[model samples]
Target: MAVRELDDLDRAIVYALQENARKTSTSTIAERMDVAPSTVRTRIQALEADGVLTGYHAEIDYERTGLQLHTLLVCTAPVPEREELAERAQEVRGVVAVREVMTGQENVHIEAIGRDGDDLSRIGRELDEIGLTIEDEDLIRNEYETPYDGFNVASE
Candidate 1:
């Protein structure tokens, strides 16, 4: 599909939603933007119809939910097999997220999960046998947490 243009208000609306998806309402946003609620609704519909507003979900706080380790299982694999590896990696225990990124000199990236050192090591070993080279590892610190909710349309 061709890329459509976004106006200032549209951008503002997207920004507001991205910040707090659960809190804002069209009426409330209209009030802040000094526009009518119907206008707010109209713009929102346009955004959604254009496939901009994908969806929403309640982002869970893993640390508070008994999730122990959150680490990436970076893999160096051929570009053609990225999707297959991602699908397989998802079934591994404790993985929070996965992506196919431009990993410097590598082609794909896989995020693995573990609650402790053993889990990380075990996953690494399994991945290595499958040609998934572990590039780097780190602890899942809350300091770098993002709610992962697609977007927010809450008030300013």
Candidate 2:
């Protein structure tokens, strides 16, 4: 499908949905943006069809759930081993995210969540056993996120 250019109204709709996709209704967005409810719905449908509006998901707090440690593991492997190493890291118990990074000293990055330092160390060992050399580790203290801030450009 050809990409659709989103107008100002469409931008407003996206911003509203980003704030709260499940609770925010089409009518509420229409009232806020001063457009018809059908217009908001139609635009949302088009956005989804165009792959702009992806799946809605809830962001869970791991600390609240008792899995408190959030660590980023950076490792380097032989070019042939990068894919396999990343796949193996994903199977690790505490791993939350894994990515093959191209531009950096490290070739692979893994985000793992654990109950504590021991759990994190166990996860690191699991990856190390797969031939991933641990180059660096960073513990995430906190994260502040605001979704779709760029899509709210209509207000600017």
Candidate 3:
């Protein structure tokens, strides 16, 4: 389908949905906008078709699920070694997420979850060996208050 620009109503719908996907159902959105539910449904389907609404999934608390450790590793990668650094991070036992960043000097950012401090230290050391200067480390105590992204963007 062709990509069309979002109109005022479209932006409003998207904004409402971004705040709470479930709250803005076809009927609710129609009622709020004084339009027909089918119209709302059609627009929503079109939005999904256009890839604006990718998907949805539940958010679970990792700590409650025995995943208490959260560590952010901001490492600087030397020239032409990002792929190798990614591989090394993947080999780490409890690295949940590793992403190549676009920061001017920083090469990649790693978000890892280990069982204990020892695991974190192990990961830190691994990065050091790879010549990646570990810039910062922080514990993620609670990540529930982030802005609500109506669509699903999650790991497995």
Candidate 4:
């Protein structure tokens, strides 16, 4: 697929959505960008169709929901099977997210949440069953995110 080039308006729209998609309405973006609401809506549709904008996800705080352990499972999978195993790992209980890195080793990173050590062990075992060699595990303390500044049209 050809990459879709984004203009200033598209960048600004993406920046606004990244800041708060749920609260950022087309009308609000229109007001900020001085464009019509319909124009903003059309741009958003185009962005989605082009795959520049994916799904909007909620920022979850697992610790507040009783899942105390937020762990990063560093695993290594054979390069040929890495993608398949990463997708399969998502189906494992307690697994929240899986990332595939383009490296020779420690190429798969799995994010999982568990109530305690026993739950984490089960998740680890399940990952191992799926052909991922567990290399290390780290308990996450905190995570933070902010809108990408490059997409901030005002900055340009």
Q: Whose TM-score is greatest here?
A: 4
Candidate 2, residue 16: CA error in Å? 2.3
RMSD (Cα, Å) for all candidates, in order, is 4.4, 2.9, 6.6, 0.8
TM-score of each: 0.73, 0.76, 0.64, 0.97
Is 1 or 2 the stronger prediction by TM-score? 2
Q: Which stretches of candidate 4 lie over 4 Å from their true place?
A: none
Write one digit per residue (lDDT tens) for candidate 4, span 1-156.
889888988999999999999999999889888999999999999999999998999999999999999999999999999999999999999999999999989999999999999999999999998899999999999999899999998987
Tell me the tens digit of each residue's lDDT in model 1 across 83-138.
67766766666665667786544555665556578877877777666655677776
> Rank order by TM-score, top first?
4, 2, 1, 3
lDDT values for all models = 0.68, 0.85, 0.74, 0.95
Candidate 3: tens digits of C-alpha lDDT, residues 76-98: 88658876887787776777778
Question: Candidate 3 — which pairs collide?
Answer: none
1-156, model 2: which lDDT tens digit per residue?
667788888788788888888899999888878889998999989888889888887877888998878888999877777888888889999998899987445899998999988998898888889888889999888866676776785558
Candidate 2 lDDT for residue 141: 81
Candidate 1 achieves a global lDDT of 0.68
Lowest lDDT sum, 10 consecutive residues, model 4, at: 1-10
